[model samples]
Target: MGKWNAKGLELAQKLEGVTDEKAIKKLATETMQEIIDACPGEGSIKRPRAALRKAIESVYPSLNAEDNYPQGYYRTSEGKGKGERYEHLALWYLTTNIDRWSVEGDEGRQQYWGNLPTLEKTEPKPQQTKQQKPKQKETVMSQLNLDLDTETQQALDFALKQSGLEEKEFISRAIAYYAKSIANRHEVDFATIPTEKLLNDSSLAKLPGRAEELTRRAVRAISIYNDDIAPENSERWAITQSAIARLTGGRAKSIQKALEDYQGMIADHHAKYELNNYSNRKSGGRTIEDTINIAEL
Candidate 1:
């Protein structure tokens, strides 16, 4: 591929779109689904790994691609021949290099810059003239350090009390949402999506009772997300309700958020999981029902 020009950065920024703070926050969410949709499957013409390699090469064509995967690449064949060798290599490469973006600081959450490991800094040169002042040493700090002034803290506390959402709740949910947004952007496996079932159904439902329940719920949730049925409609609602219950272990507040997030994902994935139902026609899409029996589970 040719060099990744300003055009690529421009396209990525365009993909981000123009917006104010609130609008940007919402767009931050939609970007996650876009990343997920780009996930590779049986006939991946452009695997995420390959696409990333191309992007990196475009920027630094002289860089050795093999050096990027020193452990050698995995074959995409099935059974004993298939493994996660290359996938893991690609993950480490990206984690150590690209795949970074910044988020704007919110009320309780702050964003940080990410990059590959850096070499030690060299000492500053001595001033040539005595009149020149010595360079001040820099102090690095973690973002978690509280930067709020007393008045700002007081106002925030009062607002939380008035809103009936304790500071803990606000902070916890904000962190969860922000973290999920990042995961979505990076196309990291949503621990929420079950992959074990897709590989092998076997007697997954016959494991030890507790294990069986966990496996069953995961299989069902994966089914719902990958299915072609209308995920936002009534039929899918049952699955969403069950998924929330499973994820939150029956906590009311947890259930509320889980349900909201699950529905949000369904809406975000509408193009894949069509919302329309046509009983007479057979669909190439997977059925959300067969994968998950929420009421029975």
Candidate 2:
């Protein structure tokens, strides 16, 4: 399309910024008529100069330019070869204000190339590219030293192997499991109720594992308290106590009450486990669980 001569260059210059296909076609038709008029003889079929043809081709990328697509002759072949023949003039038609055009045959074809020339401005738009942050490298791998007793160490190892995970991953998962089970997220007290209540309640019955879920949450809270409230644990600091009191609406007695409630839950579980069993099959021990006084225990 770049073989433009002096005349073609002049035509291109005349059609500059004229992106509308209709406008370009009108200009092209006017140019062709002028060329025909300039020919020495009236009936002479003059081949257009390379410059003129290049100018048109540059403007229109399609096979034939004029009116719209399929405006020129259709070359119908009987058998082999390159399929069809075109006897009409083919030229480029600009569809966008940008460097884009459609090939047209005459004023007859309806199909277009690239984007259809709209009345609205069709300039290619710039995009907003996001800037990404560079990732930071890990500096230190913080470690925890658990001085586990023989039984606990054995259990940890057994659990690590059983869960098919690395020691650190196993510990992390274990902590997450217990931590996530807490009822402290909402005010619902799972520790105070039995599974039967949730199971029997018509409203809760349809909720699968509602009782177990609540029970797990309650158990998690107890476990957290048992582990963290010890003097050695980081959570047992004076600041933590003050924070807890402040979180409980600055009620001085609330923390005490909560502690007593949590203690009661642990005692209840221990008492139940010790006394309520039908039998300890491994130990060959029998239980008179009903007769055991919880207060005495």
Candidate closest to the true structure, highest lDDT: 2
Candidates' lDDT values, in order? 0.36, 0.38
For residues 28-107, write the lDDT of model 1, one tens digit per residue.
32232233223322133234434544443343333233345422222222238444322211212232111221223321
Query: Candidate 2, 8: how far from true, in Å?
Result: 1.4
Task: Give each model a TM-score.
Answer: 0.22, 0.21
Overall local distance difference test of candidate 1: 0.36
Sequence-dependent TM-score of model 2: 0.21
Error of 1 at 9 (Å): 5.0
Question: Residue 59 in candidate 1 has what lDDT?
Answer: 36
